[model samples]
Target: MHDFPDIDYTQRFIFDESDVRGELVALERSYAEVLAKHPYPEPVAQLLGEMLAAAALLVGTLKFDGLLVLQARSLGPVSLLMVECSSEREIRGIARYDESLITPDATLQELMPDGDLTMTIDPRQGKRYQGIVGLDGVDLSACLSSYFVMSEQLPTRFWIKADGKRARGLLLQQLPAARLTDPEEREASWQHVNTLVDTLTAEELLSLNNETVLHRLFHEDAVRMFDIQPLVFRCSCSRERSANALVSLGLEDAQQLVIEHNGTVEIDCQFCNQRYLFDATDVAQLFAGGGVDTPSDTRH
Candidate 1:
């Protein structure tokens, strides 16, 4: 195992002479925090970590105020894998898998047979946009590459790696006609950068710092690096949000649940495993359109 620094951030870089941009993300504490909430299998954890890194990388490329979610759904052992990265760089992820069906060495195709990847961009003040692509590629990185090629009509490539403890990703994309306008030059530049990036191994991608990795890969190219943006593991679930969920159940149904559970109704957040208990009085107050005080016990 590599002794990585206590860092979790994403940095953007652009080629000075070419019309290409890129982002590199390295996640350690945020990845560990998400895994601590659930006892995921090794393969499941690795895939989830990769998804977390992928979400962060994609969100860095966009200019939205809401969130970017990367989700995969299938009918195999791993039923669902979802990761969300807010515009503020807070991330949370969860995985659903059947223990009995999971093998020690299950490939992505075996674990997620018939799966499809969905990229959703939800802005704070506009309509949400979503793009779906079939899981035709062997791994998450390849699937994402196909998404950009088909949906966005941009030439994009990704190098993603995860080992249950840390996750890192590198993305190279060709922007619209800018510094390099000639079509032939654009193609040549894209190919040249991608060809060099192809030499990057999973070990190097997961272990090296952004500067070292960039230098090792593109030392001769004129690259402009940007400031790093911090990322953290933060579940969106809160006591207020849980209370709103009880309200959505309606007073009658909410009261019945409280009665069936011996004067208390417990709501557990799947992503963070935090419990929210509403007793008879709390339920009544919620129904009365009054504020409900905090629960007696809360788990972090």
Candidate 2:
């Protein structure tokens, strides 16, 4: 029987002796929240959900206090797909796919034919960094693991699963600093744990609770599980920030932008599909140096 829970869960676990750690994230409502915003194709929605789950899992393991983004940029029908997750587990995501007809069994290659997977880490008080990698793998999880191996110089493995209900993933990393003298033990332990994780199926990942998943993967080993962190869907878009951006553009550029956009420069928040419209007067006020005016909230 599958041990399922009513709430989504993201938890960190560590081995007692090995320099290895793992993260398990099971998401349902949060994944649904992201998919509700746009009418994405089936493959695109699945890809975004998988990426979101992977981002949450990465956030659980990383030590940075900033936002981490997973982006897939392509020249195919699907131009771009991204998921941004903060260290605090707040996530927002969206995907752009050009195709109108997407079948249920569509693969990542079908959605993003020619694309590159990039990971960006933006700290609150440091220089932002980005790493680019080719999208040779078939799924988002594979691409993410590739990024970790290339960027962090760590041997990492990822197991990701997603469907209409929710998306989930498990991550394992063998620390780079521990490979000096006694590499055999750590590598053996990592292989032992990963071998068990390989038996996990998409249904088990999406349906099982965090503790259950951990137990299934490492029941015989000594696994120290951390407290579960709550994950939520949040879009950090506001009229004030939008207005500030307009002001930063200065007067001349703002005027040209308004004219180019037919006197109304509308910026839509991709995650939430919230549109922020700035008309000529709005642009003028922004450039006139007045405090940003509150936009009348309009909901579709």
Top candidate, metric TM-score: 1
* lDDT by residue (tens digit), candidate 2, 136-254: 78787788778777876678889998886688889998765453246677667778888898899888787778787788878887889888888888888887777888888888998
> What lDDT score goes with residue 137 in model 1?
87
lDDT of 1 by residue, 101-195 (tens): 99988889989998999999999989999999987689999999999989866788999999998899999989999898999999999999999
User: What are the models' TM-scores?
Assistant: 0.96, 0.89
Q: State how far residue 288 of model 2 sits from its true place (Å).
A: 2.2
Candidate 2 collision pairs? none
lDDT of 2 at 238: 87
RMSD of each: 1.7, 2.8
Q: Show model 1 residue runs off by greater than 4 Å.
A: 1-5, 294-300
Best by lDDT: 1
